[model samples]
Target: MSNVISAKNLTLAYDNGRKEIIKNASFNIKKGDFVFITGPSGSGKSTLLKSLYGQLKPKEGNLVVGGRDLANIGSRQLQELRTHMGIIFQDYKLINEWTVAKNVVLPLMIAGYSLDVQETQAHRLLKHVKLSEHADKYPLELSGGEQQRVGVARALAKNPVVILADEPTGNLDDYSSNVIWDLMENACQQLETTVLVVTHKIPTIFSLPYRHFIIESKGVYEVH
Candidate 1:
């Protein structure tokens, strides 16, 4: 199987003079695979996700995603690299002033797609996430779960090769959580998108069949 992400002996630290959160961590995500990243509150789960998405550079070791060497890539290249990736944050980062369709179209606009084309894509994705009725509503008017559904729609709008999610179900109830997971699972199976989720929902994760990676005070481990 081909690999979508590969990090070798990766070490990550903050620029704020804090201690290294992850040390000598290495892993690979094969194409079309779904993987779970879990750890204690401060065990570097979010740090690892940021590094993988190029928000933070590795202090030591090589990091590669989709055949691009992250360490050697320039800012322009990093932006381009992100075109093949979709990221979901714990807080639904939807623009409060923008309508649901407009929020979902943000990525497409950044990619310089035509407005009409973005509209079509946005509508399709909103329907996919079952938010078609709220297409004209502003994010602030939606519930937390409804807003998160919009986030998922936005994430998948670009048809990215990889999806990175950080605490995607953090504030959701059981029904909403299951809905979000189903959308993510659909993305993985139907779009051949590799999924890397940083979440603390171990009980839910334990029931799913996915490769697991755990980060602790000691180091990173690939758990079967």
Candidate 2:
């Protein structure tokens, strides 16, 4: 398969390069691959994930996602690139004012789908995420796990080519975490969506062949 994400000699830093996180790290993730990036707190796992989604530019070297080189991408280009990607955050990032279905409809709305089409997709995706009963509920009314499930549904609503999840199950119970993992795994296997997740631990019950990478001491290494 073709590479969906590629990093060559990548160096990432923050605060005007005063805080260097990753240094000279290189890796490639192929299309339709399920990848887990693990590291302890302060290890730069999130930093690497941020770079993949264009939230952080490389301090040095080349980083590419969906064939777009992030090193010199413009704001307009970055916005365009994000439309094709699904991103799930640790905090769920749902708009409290919007109901669950509406939140899932946001991406389709942004993509200019008709209201009818948007609602249809929202309903379909919410069902897939097993949140159909809670579609009309506000985000604040749900539990942490339910809120994150909404986030996952929203991310998949656009049928994105790749999904980037940063510590997606960091605050969930085992059952909830497994549900989230199953949804992502299904996307990878059924829809051929590439998934790259940053987390402190990889669930031992994950029952699929996947690539594993770990961040340590300012470098990234793949585990066999």
Candidate 3:
């Protein structure tokens, strides 16, 4: 499979270039692969992810995602590139007013799926995440784990080609975190989605295959 995300000689910084995060970084994530970006806090793992989703532009070098160059895309074009990606944040970016099912189906609705199809897929995804019983509950009414599962359901609603997760299980218990990992692995295997997760700590033992990439000394290093 070809590269779904490619970064070459990439650099990301903040504060008007006063702070440099990733400098001269290069990496490639192929289609249908499960990968992890691990580093200490403030090492720019999140910034690198932002570049992939076009949330942050590279300060230098080339960053291409889904075959589109992100370093210089217009606003509308960046939005178009994002349509091919699903993002999961640590805080579970969900509307408190919306029920779990509604939250899960938002992507489908935005994609203009019929109400009937949205209902069907939303329910199916909820069931997959073991949140069927909580589908009618609002995001605030559920625990953090449940809300994260809802986020997972929402991310999968669009059948995104690439899924970007930022500390998705950061605040969850072992059970919940393991469940989330299982769900992600299953999605990669079943839907062939390229999954990239940014976290500070990855379990020492894991069954699913994944590449381990670390950021340190102002660069990205893929562990062999």
lDDT of 3 by residue, 145-218 (tens): 98999999898888899999999999999888988888888889999999999998886556878998999989
Report the number of clashing residue pairs per model. Answer: 0, 0, 0
Give Cα-based local distance difference scores for all models. Answer: 0.88, 0.94, 0.90
lDDT of 2 by residue, 36-85 (tens): 99988999999999998898999999999989999999999998999999
> Any idea what lDDT model 1 has?
0.88
lDDT of 3 at 62: 97
Clashes in candidate 1: how many? 0
What TM-score would each prediction reach against the true structure?
0.95, 0.98, 0.97
Candidate achieving the largest TM-score: 2
- Model 3: lowest-lDDT 10 consecutive positions: 200-209
Best by lDDT: 2
Superposed by TM-score, candidate 3 places the C-alpha of residue 220 at a distance from the truth, in angstroms, of 0.4
Model 2 whole-model lDDT (C-alpha atoms): 0.94
